[model samples]
Target: MHMTDVLAAADISKAVAAFAAADSFNHKQFFVMCGLKAKSKDDMKKVFHILDKDQSGFIEQEELCLILKGFTPEGRNLSDKETTALLAAGDKDGDGKIGIDEFVTLVSES
Candidate 1:
């Protein structure tokens, strides 16, 4: 499944507006607003795959910086601090990248 199939353009716009208004990246709120919180584990895996742009089997910090763009063309890049926080949250094994299982767990728990 493709990202556009999961999150529509309207949803991406709404998320962008919210982020602009707040001037900060709220991971949980963004997920909730984008309907990601209700997605099944399998769906989340699909999302992880989509985000893993290099097919590296993991999401590295550099990719995390551009993660929002994976959702939409107009989505902004994450700030360095936001990227670091997100990576720290999901890189549970301390390998400095987020593996599939860790990605699922991080999103699920959020």
Candidate 2:
């Protein structure tokens, strides 16, 4: 299945899942899963590419919302309060935009 399909099917922490599968995804297994090959840097780039659908070199609000949908893979959707909090925390410019850098930073910090 596609990664996003795996994500949507999950009912737990994606971080936990990814970490648990780290051995496989770290360098080798990702190739097997995706039918492609790449170095670590390339892999990271692909992830960011997937996150930046608009190809604006930055993630926007809609992109962020899609990402937030996957944050809690436990099938426990975020409450309105939680969503608001997430936007507030990551919307650095406060122009109602959360760029890819901001999202990446927020996810990394979390």
Q: Give me the displacement of residue 42 in model 1, in angstroms.
A: 0.6
Residue range 43-102, candidate 2, lDDT tens digits: 434555665667787655565445423333332333444445556776777866666566
Where model 1 places Cα greater than 4 Å from the true spot, the runs are: 21-23
Q: Which parts of model 2 have CA positions greater than 4 angstroms off? A: 1-68, 71-76
When superposed on Cα atoms, how far off is each prediction in RMSD?
1.7, 9.4
- The lDDT of each candidate is 0.82, 0.45
- Candidate 1 residue-wise lDDT at 56: 98
Give me the overall lDDT of model 1. Answer: 0.82
* C-alpha lDDT of residue 55 in model 1: 93
The numbered model that scores best in TM-score is: 1
Q: Provide TM-scores for the models.
A: 0.90, 0.43
